[model samples]
Structures are given as structure tokens and as C-alpha cells.
Target: MANNQENTSEKKKSEKKSEKKADKKQPNKIAKWFKDLRIEFKKVVWPSKKTVINNTSVVLAVVAGAAILVGLLDTGFLALMRLIYQ
Candidate 1:
């Protein structure tokens, strides 16, 4: 029927329009990503210098403690191996 044909053609035209609209949005995706990144960066709360220094000191102290523990364990294991083998 002519009506069916007209309806089908109209559907095809709308699909083409939608496809073109989607194509136009491709370039905006990168711009939108950077804009969103800038907005999120603005929302970040940075630590103060004193807070940073305190955190850094805590981290270094923990690292030093762990290193000493590992060293002691290593030395004890080596001494045991020497006593067992010799």
C-alpha cells in the first residue's frame, strides 16, 4: 500500500537524521570529558602543608619499622641455616 510505503520512508528518514545527530556529537565527547575533568579537579580538597608533612613522617616511620623487622628476620634465618649446616 502507498500508506505503508510512506510510513517506511518516513522511518528511514528519521533514522538517517538520528545517525547524523550522533555523528555530530562525536567531536563533543572529548570536549565534554575535559570539561568534566576540570569541574572535578575544582572540587578536590587538597591537604595542608602541615597535614602532608605529618602523613609523610608517619609513612616513613612505618617503612623504617618494617625494614628493621625484615632485616632481623633475615639475620635470624641466616644464623639458623649456618648452625644447621655446620
Candidate 2:
């Protein structure tokens, strides 16, 4: 019975030590994460102004073309329906 009591006391001491170590490490972990994020952002490649403008114009042209095509199809369908009903 005495040996069992000693063993339980030793386990409790070790658990408290581990909990203190974990508390100290929490701030270090957050600092390391922010440091890694800054390094990763430095490695990123950004697009140039000319390249961005070219891609934007291409997207706008395609959208305008699609809109015109849909409008034409809608008008043709409406005319056909009118003729059939008359």
C-alpha cells in the first residue's frame, strides 16, 4: 500500500511538470507560425500591371460576346412564337 501511494504521487508531479512545459510552448508555437507565414509571402510571384490588364480585357470581351449571343437567341425564339400564335 505504501508503494502504490508513492507511485501515484510521482505520476501527479510528472503531470504538473508537463502541463507547465505545454503552457510555455504555446506562445512559441504562435510566433513560429507567423514567422513561417511571412517567409511564404515573400516567395509569392505577383502579376504585372500589363498582364493584369490584358487578362481583364479578355474576360470582359468573352462576357460581352456571350451576352449578345443569348440576346439574339431570345429575340429569335420570341419572334417564332409570335408567328405561330398569330
Candidate 3:
């Protein structure tokens, strides 16, 4: 009986210690998270104005090419449908 009571008290003490440790770290964890995010954002190398303009032009060209290709395919498909349905 005494051994069981001692074990229960010991368990309670350890749990309280764990709770205190977690309470102490709560603010530190948030501060550390923000610090890490700031560091990661600083590490990013943003594109220059010239590079951005060149990339934009390339994207626009690709979109135009795809649009033309799709239009042609659609016209051919419509012709084929008309032939079969008529």
C-alpha cells in the first residue's frame, strides 16, 4: 500500500514538472517560429525587373501558341462531326 502511494505521488510530481517546462517554452516557441520565418524570407533572391519582363513575355508566347493550336484542333473536330452527323 505504501509503495503504491509513493508511486502515485512520484507520478504527479513528474507531470507537474513537465507542465512547467511546457509553460516556460510557450512564448519562446512563438518567438523562435517568427525568427525562423524572417530568416527564410530574407534568404529569398527575388527576380530583377528585366528578368521578370523576359519571363512574362515567354509565358505570353506560350499561351498564344497553345490558344492557336487548340483553335485549329477544335475546327478540325467540328468538321469531322459535321461529316458524320450529316
Best by TM-score: 3
lDDT of 2: 0.99
* lDDT (10s digit) by residue, model 3, range 16-80: 99999999999999999999999999999999999999999999999999999999999999999
lDDT of 1 by residue, 10-35 (tens): 99999999999999999899899999
- The whole-model C-alpha lDDT of candidate 1 against the native structure comes to 0.99
lDDT of 3: 1.00
- Where does candidate 2 stray beyond 4 Å? 74-86
Candidate 1: minimum summed lDDT over ten consecutive residues — where? 22-31
lDDT of 2 by residue, 1-86 (tens): 99999999999999999999999999999999999999999999989999999999999999999999999999999999999999
- Ten contiguous residues with the weakest lDDT in model 3: 20-29
